[model samples]
Target: MSTAQPPEDRNTLEDSLDALPELSYSMELVQKVQGGEGGAMDELLERYQPRMRRIIAIKMGAKLRRQIDVEDILQEVFLIAFRKIEGLELRSKASILRWMAKIAQNVMHSKVDYFSAQKRSAGKEVSLHGLAPSSDSLEPQISAGVTSPSQRAARSELQELVDRQVERLEPADYREVILLRDYQECEWDEIGSLLERPTVAATQGLYRRAHLKLRKQMRKHLEHPE
Candidate 1:
């Protein structure tokens, strides 16, 4: 007469469920919100809010903190999502989170377009030739005014410079590996998830290729001394 299931029964159930393809939880929450569930909306907010904050913080932390807060962006995204969510056609049940993320892209794109249009109207050329992204050399001994404290400072600056240079890599895969190894500083195994490759292959091939390109660019930059 005991109601409790045996451990074997529970294990079998869990194993069966785990056998199916796993899906992202965000999509589930978004669908729930779309169904007019108040609690689901709140749950979506709670779940995505932290990720939104971290992404914005990492991208724009040095900007004017007084002008914008990440929470404000989250609010804006929520409002925008509400207005546009009805129009979205579900590509797949799994794509709900991706669709909402596209909304975020549009929000950011619209703001950027507005500001850029305004800047152009003022007759200002935003692009300064030679001021665009350029790589730098890390030849410590070759540069002057770089010894002891100054050398350490120069080394730090060079590291930052190399990081910035990595952002300019062309082709999606090349840039991705560089970002994984340099900016986000994620492990090869973690990077593989983003790249959809084996960890050993990602490290040996993509990582190595990216690093070689970086080294060549750095040497060239030092030679030019710009």
Candidate 2:
């Protein structure tokens, strides 16, 4: 009887364990934080911080970037999320990131306002126009797993260059489409809803036109840099 009856018992135990319900990684953290578990908020922030950082960096542009550190913007985003997390439905993992991206965009806008006010006080001209986003023509081919400091510096430089050209996109809707499609990773349906387009096809058409216009601008930059 040296544990000879154990195989069936182990199989039953494994089956029972497998049958237990499991929450998604995001949902689990969200639940814990909402339930007021210690450290849950920090864990949630840590998990989502990287993506938010990238969004802030990509959207802040050269002017806002000069006046505000990316980390500061990210911190504000996380603070807003933490305060409002309990009320957020966070229906899905994608929802969590989408919510954060929206918050980050808002934070960027606020910072821009503050900076513009300062410029106005100094009697400097402030322009509300923004260029379009990444171009299909000259977008940088950043290799995967290139996370060294030098590579990050190179990527940031290229991104800033692209961003500078985007500021020249005519009509604000073009910029909004690029930010929604590329940075926010929104579905066509969601983007259409936000953009007030009647259909997904219409939303896509707008994005295509915006992309082509941005590409032309980027091409000009590559061809002639002053």
Candidate 3:
């Protein structure tokens, strides 16, 4: 019997295997802002604000989606960018977006850790007999024999590894494609717009190439594991 992988594992495997396109409007805005032109930062923010919010919302995950406020995180991300933009060396438009995404990812991870700790502490006060089996308890069964905690840790590590590899990819377009499609989970249309592709099909082809490269990198990582 063939056993299905857990959703997280499947998505991680599929998504990890994933471009920037030509310089467009955002690139010009990034150049202007980097050059310290007046009102350029505001224009850049205006252009990317929606994209940033979408990225934060998607990365927040389902567990924290209801509990955490995306707007607050979005504001904090932009605020940090505002304060630190001068010091940052943004080589391309993709670099700026990726930098912002990293900040959002860090903030979201910290929040998840905080809430998880709170839940763990509260769990300890409850009677073991009174507690019901959680999704955690059923993880192995749901994962087709893989333990949840360990699998989750491995998945997280793999994602981090893939992200680092993506940074080293040649042609900034490939890096941007992975960041937007895989990391942020944006739709092809949106990705196409950002990448300045004429159609979703063009963007899809770009993503496929990027994914193949990422898969090769992952294979190498597994083989070496250093």
Candidate 4:
């Protein structure tokens, strides 16, 4: 009556799950969405929405948050993403979110431009949480001090692996902290401010724990890649 899978069969199933491709920006997902696969776009958007919302919040800041709801901005951002999904280029596993972030920046800038024009005409000044309408580049895409693998192929593999593992970080804030500090290149204080960490030390502590968890997962995957 046990009816459980045999040990060998269970091992195979676990390996399959371990090897399951990164959910959101996988080549298969992109192709599915571009090829008009039903529900593909929905799945893709669902996977990336939380990260996208944080990006919008940082870009919009507290000042802009009062003027426009983040959800409203997210609607426009996703609308544009849906319309333009075909043009998405996946240079690396990180590419999809990068492309989406650019779209978000453009959308936020356009709204800021409208507000800036209104303020100028009214002889009032407008500020977007200390960001100007012309501000570009959501922090620099610098290395988070991770050593690159020597071989180009290995490097690319490692980068994709890192991207996948970062997406898998848990407790939401852990993912957000790594994203804000490493991916978005936010300063410690800025990360604290955006995440409401109360202090730079708090943000750093979260980043360390998140980074450790990510590294442990990455090592397990690399050691037993399936």
TM-score of each: 0.42, 0.67, 0.44, 0.50
Ranking by TM-score: 2, 4, 3, 1
The candidate with the higher lDDT, 3 or 4, is: 4
Query: Where in model 4 is the C-alpha error above 4 Å?
Result: 1-25, 132-226
Query: lDDT per prediction?
Result: 0.46, 0.61, 0.58, 0.60
Query: Taking the candidates one at a time, how many backbone clashes does each contain?
Result: 0, 6, 8, 0
Relative to the unseen true structure, what is the C-alpha lDDT of residue 25 in candidate 2, on a scale of 0 to 100? 71
Point out the higher-scoring one by lDDT: 1 or 4. Answer: 4
Give candidate 3 misplaced runs (Cα > 4 Å).
1-39, 124-226
| Predictions: Cα RMSD each | 16.4, 14.8, 16.6, 17.5
Instruction: Tell me the lDDT of model 3 at 118.
Output: 76
Writing each residue's lDDT as its tens digit, candidate 1 over 1-226 gives 1122222322321221111112356566657767876576666555444333333322322221223454555568777766666565544422433444445545554444554576699985333211111112232332234468766565546444554444444444665665444433345665677678865564547765655565566667668867
TM-score of 1: 0.42
**What value of lDDT does candidate 3 attain over all alpha carbons?**
0.58
Ten residues in sequence with the least summed lDDT for candidate 3: 130-139
**TM-score comparison, 1 vs 4, better candidate:** 4
Residue 141, model 2, lDDT: 26
Q: Which ten residues in a row have the lowest lDDT in candidate 1?
A: 128-137
* Tens-digit lDDT string for candidate 2 (1-226): 1112222222321221111112287788888988988478887776656445555665665556667787888889999998888877755335776788778878777777777898899998555432112211111223344557786565555655655554556666777666565544567777788889998778878877776777777777778986
Could you give me the TM-score of model 3 versus the true structure? 0.44
